[model samples]
Target: MESALAARLAAAPEEGIAPVHFVWIVAKDRASGTPSPMGIWSGDEDLTVTVALPDGTTASRAYLGGLGLEVEGLQYVADLTDNPVTVTLSQIAPAAQALVRGLDVRLAPVEVHATTMTGGALTSAPQLQWVGIVDEGPISTPAAGGAGGIALSIRSEIMTQLGQVNPAKSSDVHQKRRAAGDRFSEYAAVIGERKMQWYKR
Candidate 1:
């Protein structure tokens, strides 16, 4: 089986080898509706998740979190499937706590248009590049630490046939345009500028 690291790196194109950047756009505050900047931080903690497979078995996995990556890198990581991803944040700050108080965060990093840990040589360090929605909740501590941070669990958007994107249907839609001979009309307009740019290429 392919290693998780291999799987994530596979998300990027062969030519992409730039440094990754982690970003988090804290959802707008419930009271003010104002969002937080994509705060970048080092010394991020590891991400762990418990995944239940199709068969009668379960597995626990971990990945590097608290890091950022551009869109290209993020896309690669987001392609990961069949497993749940979760992140744990330590040392909560008052301001950040406000943002995390009650919100589903958006992992919208910057665009990558162009583009871990200790122990021994055998030590494993995986960097998280996946981008998606995550559920957040507060963690309580009974120790003298007296404070804790939020834990983020990746929310899979996958669905059954009813909700899945039909590639064939998309192909048919594009083919219809091809058969239209590139004619533009008031009734037939295309939005999604980014997708249009890709389709044009």
Candidate 2:
């Protein structure tokens, strides 16, 4: 009975096979002022990586263990781990850091004077405008923005609060992807051997 079940299980098709590798390419986007990873590659022990630098140059190499590659003139580092490879660029790049710093400074709300129009006319009506104030009303608390906006704000705050959170998340995703990829690779190897045996029989 156990043998029969085992045979049935072996014969069953794989349902959902997730990618075994998650690659995080941490680099500055020239257009968008955000840090992001370029690509994630997944595989087992043996893997080939082709790195193309910002300069018109490329290098292809095979890596073992955790691979870290850096070019002298380039401002990025390519890190290849067991599961996914992560490439991180220096946030404080010479040309871009000043712009980034300026943006950071500008993130604070700038006070601007504006004329308020009432009833489609510039009427001098003495009305208390709730500007830059939170109204904690009775019955219920003053609601903030929409669910999506709030959620996004929360996520952004969390990410910003914990700077290394992104790296940690990337690492976790990489591990999961690697495990899945390895399992699939192993299964493929097994199936190939089984087919060979069946053909021989």
TM-score of each: 0.36, 0.15
Model 1, span 37-141: residue lDDT tens: 334333345544333333436445443344332132122344434343444455354434544565425542211011121222211332334434543344555
Candidate 2 worst ten-residue window by lDDT:
147-156
> Which predicted model would earn the best TM-score?
1
User: Which parts of model 1 are misplaced by more than 4 Å?
Assistant: 1-21, 44-82, 102-128, 143-147, 158-201
Alpha carbon lDDT at 167, candidate 2:
45
* Residue 79 of model 2, lDDT score: 44
Error of model 2, residue 171, in angstroms: 46
- Clashing residue pairs in candidate 2 are 20-177, 20-178, 20-181, 21-177, 23-40, 25-37, 25-38, 26-37
lDDT for 1 in candidate 1 is 21
Native-to-model Cα distance after best TM-score fit, residue 193 in candidate 2, in Å: 88
